[model samples]
Target: MMATADEGVILVVEDDGAVRNLVATALDVHGYRHREAASATAALLDLTSSTDINLVILDLGLPDRDGVEVIEALRGWSRMPVIVLSARQEDADKVAALDAGADDYLTKPFSVEELLARVRVALRRLAYDSPATPTEAAIYRNGELLIDFGAGVATRGGEELHLTPIEYKLLALLARNTGKVLTHNYILKEVWGEAVASDLPSLRVFMATLRKKIEPDPANPRYLQTHVGIGYRMLRVEEAARL
Candidate 1:
């Protein structure tokens, strides 16, 4: 998914030799180049040292150290896309990983197709993993508040935001449309996929967080205006001269 005309690398960190090779081979068949690390320490080393690694498939069970530690440890500075692999299929487990900055999670005995799809979702979440031109990428700016579409960075009142993956995705979607009347379904499709379009509760929570970050007042939203049954919009602020 590198913008440049070269192969991008995906790092697979799994303790199981068979699983590691299986996942790596699947990626290879899908035309993605990759490297593998068997232990958490080596994974950290690969993550820290490489500028080539675009994404990671991380196993939560490691030989040398705890897998959650690897995530907590990597999240200290890196924002690279991380898709956690876990044998536990509990909702709490998935939530925990997501809350800790993992992009997505896959339970064991997963299909290769699903694995590739999750990787695609992670790449999409990263907001500039494709070969799109910088100019074509969507962005929004109003004085001190700025949203860079290609960079996946949001700033408000002149300070950068440390947004989660879902938050960033929602921001990009709204920022792209700006004044347009984007429906709730539209927003869901753009951010969480069509499958979760009816999951308004989840979307509402994300929207509320987005308002708190970008709006002058979350209760009385200024930048992000809600249209009730409709979706939200990032209002285009007019210059003082216009008034």
Candidate 2:
């Protein structure tokens, strides 16, 4: 079945009434069903009590608790997509939210169009990861890049791109979660296990090398996008084409 904006229920968690209303209005205009929560407690209650909430648009500052805390709490069980919408512009804040398990981050005074675009991406990823869909494929293709997971090889434009073992692991991890942000800590834990979970420097070095192998112009990358202090995301082929 084709996915539509009306297919899932979105939870909008913002303490600021004006901002919350604005976000809710945009979702309503876009034909999306949504629920609103003015505080972290309310948000968490709603999330835990309801199984139909498909995604979340959360603000960092809440009346009762910090948004990152809510994200961490939510991550304790749910893999539901959370997009942090905050006034906190610092890379540190963004990294914190992502590390706490947010799927995406958008700073306050954001463009509605961009927010909706991100919502679409998140929801699409949710659908893609749903059990109804096959979790893994023998091969994954994005434009000229093709990763044959079964064969354990990646190629670009019909040519095999030699990648280090670490690079290959990183590529496969990102590819599997395309369109979702992967924090340094999360990537490290997943790819290298807990022993080197704090090794951000090594992850950066490996990611740099991986980009060079797959990207036609590493200077202007079309596939992998760096989120500065946050982490990295593997853009879907259609999304990368726009970049």
Candidate 3:
């Protein structure tokens, strides 16, 4: 049975008519309501006209204007999730889109399963971040670092640690998903967005900065362990404290 779901409305912004149709058809079959726009201008107009849009699947190669600008403009007023669907596979391009505020990025020739998985992850995050979602952890302890998600504070050895917004988000995401290996793409989507998922250098740079603050020795991270070509892992209590 095709399970009926009120997953929420989505806006598809793509210049390719066939691609747009494909995406719309998939969303429809999955029981999601969607609208389509052929250009950045149309996308902006649709966003302004409609207030119920829960997510946006945007293509970076639009005819009217750069999709990065659209992402920035939308970030100025909205927290709606954006998944960038573009053919540009270059790392720089991906970084630009992600840094612009895209929640997820998908290269062209992507599989339907991958696209749908990204959509589900993006929407799941949207719900978790929503105020309607109740949360319980006031303090998260991973070795010496203490993250107070409720109070928006993090401390090390009893002193509050100053962390950038991105740094904090990274830490919180890892802490919540403790003992799990988060792929680079997953981290980017959850932390920065999909557009920046392919920007491994940027992720490494931020991770380095974050380690300096929390790790007793950034050279030898006790809490944040790199998974070599795969991603990163936050070890469980017993595994992480082996300093």
- Provide backbone clash counts, one per model: 0, 0, 6
lDDT of 2 by residue, 40-150 (tens): 999999999998899999999998999999998988888788888999977667656666767666777878876886677667655444343233447888999999876
Query: So what's the TM-score on candidate 2?
Result: 0.59
Query: How far does residue 212 in candidate 3 sit from its true spot (Å)?
Result: 12
Off by over 4 Å in 2: 1-6, 131-136, 139-170, 173-243
Worst 10 residues of 2 by lDDT: 128-137
List the candidates' TM-scores in order. 0.64, 0.59, 0.68
Q: Which 10 successive residues of model 1 have the least lDDT summed?
A: 1-10
Writing each residue's lDDT as its tens digit, candidate 3 over 18-92 gives 999999999888777889999999999999888778889999999999999999999888878888899998777
After TM-score superposition, the amount by which residue 142's alpha carbon in candidate 1 deviates from its true location, in angstroms, is: 8.3
lDDT of 3: 0.78
Task: Name the runs in model 1 displaced over 4 angstroms.
Answer: 1-5, 121-151, 177-189, 192-243
Candidate whose TM-score is highest: 3
Question: Which candidate order results from sorting by TM-score in descending order?
Answer: 3, 1, 2
Would you list the C-alpha lDDT of every candidate in the order shown?
0.74, 0.80, 0.78
Tens-place lDDT per residue, model 1, 1-79, is 3233253688999999999999988887777888999999999998888888878899988999867788888889888
